[model samples]
Target: MLISNIEVIPGKRITDHLGLVQGSTVRAKHAGKDLMAGLKNIFGGELQGYTELLQESRQEAVDRMIVQAQAIGANAIINVRFSTSAIAAGASEILAYGTAVRLNDR
Candidate 1:
């Protein structure tokens, strides 16, 4: 499916609106990684572990959103948005959402 952050997809006509669709996932920090991150905080560098974790989490959320759209017969998703929220001291939720729509072949 065509997924875009913009409301309109250039040159593509939307045929139907399937309403909003969303997916989310929660992840907690690995204890070992958290300890490493604490050390890195003192040195002021990127936390590679958390970076990778969030990246994967975002992708998973998007993938799940696509599945929902596809199930509802949507060929595209527009006005895509993402959100991140802390679920607990060491956990966070990543959410992906968009308006599911059908696109004309042309």
Candidate 2:
């Protein structure tokens, strides 16, 4: 399905509004990675482990949101947005959301 952050696709018209769809996932830092991150924080360097972890989590949330859109017969998702929130000391939740819609060639 076509997914874009804009309200409309250049070559397509919105045929139906299927409503909002969202997905979220929570993840915690593993102890080994958390230790490494702590050292990196002190040394002021990029935390590669955490970066990769969050990237993966974000993709998973997007995939889930797409699944929901497909289930409701949406061919595209517009105005896509993402959010991240700390759920606990070492855990965070990532959310992906968008307006599900049917699109047809203009």
Clashes per candidate, residues 3 or more apart or on different chains: 0, 0
lDDT score at residue 71, model 1, on the 0-100 scale: 99
Off by over 4 Å in 1: none
Worst 10 residues of 1 by lDDT: 6-15
Task: List lDDT for all candidates, in order.
Answer: 0.95, 0.95
Report the lDDT tens digits of candidate 2 across residue range 18-90.
9999989999988999999889988998899988999999999999999999999999999999999998998
Candidate 2 Cα errors over 4 Å, as ranges? none
Give the clashing residue pairs of candidate 2, or none: none
